[model samples]
Target: MTESTIITDNFLLSNKKAVLLYHEYAKHLPVIDFHNHLSPLQIAEDKKFDNLTDIWLKGDHYKWRAMRALGVDERFITGQASDEEKFKAWAEVVPATLRNPLFHWTHMELKNPFGINSYLNKDSADRIYLQANERLAQDEFSARSLLKNFKVEMLSTTDDPCDDLTHHQQLIKEGYEIKVKPSFRPDKVFMIGEPVTFKAYLKVLGQKAGVEITTIASLLEALKNRVDFFALQQCSISDHGLSTLPTHFTLSLAQEQEFKTFLKSDQAVFSDPDAFAGFILTELCKMYHERNWVQQFHVGAIRNNNPRMLHKLGPDTGFDSIGDYKHAENLTAFLSHLNLTDQLAQTVVYNLNPADNEVIATMLGNFADGRIKGKMQFGSGWWFLDQKDGIEKQLNALSNMGVVSTFIGMLTDSRSFLSYSRHEYFRRIMCNLFGSEMEAGLLPDDEKWVGEMIQNICYYNAKNYFGLNRG
Candidate 1:
């Protein structure tokens, strides 16, 4: 249970001010992870892992990608290899991930939940695995217990429009203390090009909403129905994943008639997918505004890059990469269109490409309109950019171009329960960034002012922005 030399109390806190800021302001704050991909079923059932690998490695594309880079066999990475073998393989690759965020995250997770601060490697893998597995057998290591242990006050899970939400309902019935709300994610609703998949999704969505979606009008009605359903379930957020915002948002009468025909004829194809998406998404945003909801866009991911592996493993299994889509023009148009209509909801835009950091940061200013605090947010470092360097770049970009003080901070955006350590990792890096500035006289020597900002970024801003503290 003793701390390892590597993961001491002062792990990432380098300067004296950094150490002071971390321990005093950031360390004990309750985490409000506004977005993630955790399983509602697991939390509702209070699922416990049989071993460390079951909890740590399953559905973790980040580790899977790294294992592939190190030439580990697919059998060990994601194939039919036993859990023990997978753990051994991951342990062997740990030392090689020295500079990668995986190294820090791996240790931080182990240190906190398992209280095993030892550095993981091939030699220590077996012993550490046994220790972690033993702990997993205890009640405190169950899925719900883990969230409580991580000091997670609230977290939102990405869910589709047609999701039954039985698990979410179960949590509510049981009165789980942690707020686990579902964020409406209807990305599939925009897939007009893939007629077969889109058609099937529409049927399900229509059935759930109690409306038959035959035309564009009915489609909007069905979506609104689902939005109302989500609101009743205590959902106040919506998320969309796109390469970039669509510019061709207006649908002419001819195009609208064409959409109805496309719905009926299987062979019919929509010529302009962007136009279709834009039209639908614009209407959806209006509905969100009506509900007083927060909308989040996670843009710029080029997914399923490796078609061979994608076919073998299906989507979201370590084949996605940061996309270089141009954002400024279309993003501006999309937001402005909403703003002109007075339908712009509180939006947080997360870009996968590091090059788009300043683009998103500055875009936030164009739409802030003085109505809501941080109405347009440049979201936290996302996907590939959630690491230390990316976090620093995002913070610097916001500090330079936007109001960093009003910024709602980090989100796990992760599937694994153990990924809560990422918030800790982000807090330490943020404290160090500000702490170092204080020591160098770049910022004022007043701890109270800076510490309050740190606390806001760590917890308060997100709490207020999302209205998590409200009934």
Candidate 2:
């Protein structure tokens, strides 16, 4: 039998054309998934999967985007199609997905899981698909089982404050070995001027905290109560998905209080969306620092502009595009406000547009205070850049300008369970990068050290950064 076609060579260490590195170093590193969208409920239940396509292609806008790029129609992208048909469509698109990381990842998933050597295409789709579906039918391919299979040590799920986290609580009660924590995302809570939606969220928060949020102070108090609740449940991070860092302008407590008054008033226009948005982001960041939690800012995504899609599908449905903003100066202004303050917490900034990668990567170094190591970070190339070119470019920029050793690795940022294939995709890309570097004689010929470095970027940095320990 032929061995599966691995994307990178295992023995190509340090360009010396010698020395096979032990793959053991790759095996032991713990995964610190600092950002992701994995379902906490499925994790809590350890639910098994029925087939590969259901997990891989369904609801994955990332894959959908690529499939669309390949001329696959919306009927297959988001329409009602059988799982098998979708798989076949995806398989048909697989070979053409070349020069795209999905092609490599599809093969990686096949080799790593099913140990199948055949490439996914029209000719091989049926046999390969059936074999994987057979494996999925077994109990081992469940959600939690998949996490364990990929050696995910820590997973941070993005959640809104309206979430009750009953599932998170259940996972803790069962003492699940993996660390599945919540990252507080309060975007909806801060949209106060929009009466219909804001009032609804206020009610949700108010009901959950059992507080009457009639004033700005009361609203903050309600949010604080929820933050405390999340803390008790092992959440130590707050995530902000904003258009940019909050503007440096600060409202006086009295002025902010008055804004709350405006929220309750019927005269406030829903236009000029940032009135409450800017105020709430500033206050939330302050709260983040007060709690000494690591705050993550995933900024620069221009989302949901397609009216037709927005009307039908809702957010995160592939309509979001990269924004071309002045990220550096704005970031400098935002950090300048908090850099000297004692309330400043460790922060990570991820840019959606890769052209800004070098700019943001360098900007992070400017804010590092020697007071704490890794006080600031340019987060991994996210969203569209999660692919091979994306990860490689991020690694190069970070390694050249900042320390790659301090870098934390990949996050799924996905809603689908099969997206864990991303970890495999990331690992192979990392291994190939390191292996190719070793072959070029630019780095040392020490396989063990190189392997460890690869593992750290793939896993260890995130594990230690989040303090998620399984031992």
Taking all chains together, each candidate's TM-score versus the true structure is: 0.98, 0.90
User: Model 1: per-residue lDDT, tens digit, 165-192?
Assistant: 9999988888989999999999999988
Each prediction's number of clashing residue pairs:
0, 5
Considering summed lDDT, which 10 consecutive residues are worst modelled in model 1?
A: 1-10
Top candidate on TM-score is 1
Query: Which pairs clash (backbone N, Cα, C closer than 3 Å) in model 2?
Result: 14-438, 14-439, 15-438, 15-439, 48-142
lDDT per model vs. reference: 0.93, 0.75
Write one digit per residue (lDDT tens) for candidate 2, span 390-438.
8889889998989887777777778766566676566656666776777
For candidate 1, what is the TM-score? Answer: 0.98
Name model 1 segments beyond 4 Å from true. 1-5
Looking at model 2, report the run of 10 residues with the lowest lDDT sum: 11-20
